[model samples]
Target: MAVVGLPPMGCLPIVITLNSPHGLKQRGCLDSYSSVARNYNKILQNELQFMHNSLAMFGARISYVDIYEPLMEMIQGPKKFGFDKIFNGCCGTGYLETSFLCNPLSYTCPDATKYMFWDSIHPTEKTYYYLFKNTLPILDFLLKD
Candidate 1:
C-alpha cells in the first residue's frame, strides 16, 4: 500500500461554480417549468452539501464558495450592475448553442469586453477577470490561517 500526501488546504483553491440555465429558469414555485432539471439541481445541491460536510467531518479542512448565488443575483438585477443582457450569450448564432465552438472560424462577439459570455458555456476573459476581481474577498478568507 502507498500513502499519498495531500496538499494543505490553505495552499489550494477550491472553487465550485454552478451554471444551470434550466435550474434558474425553474426557480421557485413547484411547477414553473422543467421539473426534471429542477429536481436534478435540488438533488445535486443536497449531494454537494453532504459531500462538503462529510469531507469536513474527516478532518479535511475545506472552503465552500458559492458562485451561483452571486451570479444569479446579478442576472436577476442586471441593471444594478450596468449589464443589460443576461439571457443571450455574446458568442454563437445558432438555435442550440452548436455554433459557439472555440475555433478560429467560429463566430464570436465583436467586442468581448462588452459582453458577459465568450461562448455558449463559458465566459470571456473579461468576464473571468471580473469574476476573479470580485472573488478577492473569498480568496482572502480561504488563504487566511
Candidate 2:
C-alpha cells in the first residue's frame, strides 16, 4: 500500500486569501501553515516507516509517497511547470470559495491548466499530473522493491 502525505496547506488558495492582509495579492505561502505541514509530514513519514518495518514480516509493503515537497516546488516555481496562477484557483474568485461554494453563479478562469489549484483547497488536474511525475521515482522504487 502507498500512502501520500499532505501538501502544503499554506498554499491553499483560501488559506492564502483569508490569512493574508494583502489577500490574493500574495502568491507566496504563509510560513506558519507551511511549517505545520512540514512537521506533520515528518511525523507521518516516521510512523509510516515504522509501520512498514513492523509489517515487513507479513510481506506487507507500505510506501510513503511525499507530495508536500513536490507541490511546494511547483508553487515556488510555477512558471517552470507552465503554471501562471499559483495563489488562486480556477473557480470563482479563486480566493475563499470552494466545493459547494463554487456554483453556476461563480466566475471561473478561462484556462484551468494555467492554475495550480482547481478550487480553494484542491489542486488542478494539471498540478496533479505534475505531482505524479514528481513522485514517479518513489513509486517506481516501491514497485521494484
lDDT digits (tens) for residues 23-96 of candidate 2: 75656788899899889989988999999999989988888888998898898888899999888889988887
lDDT tens per residue, model 1, 8-50: 1111111101223443333221222234434555565566567
Against the true structure, what is every candidate's RMSD? 10.5, 1.7
Candidate 2 clashes between residue pairs 3 or more apart in a chain or in different chains = none
Task: Name the runs in model 2 displaced over 4 angstroms.
Answer: 143-145
TM-score of every prediction relative to native: 0.53, 0.91
- Quick one: best lDDT, which candidate? 2
- The parts of candidate 1 lying over 4 Å away from their true place are 1-60, 98-100
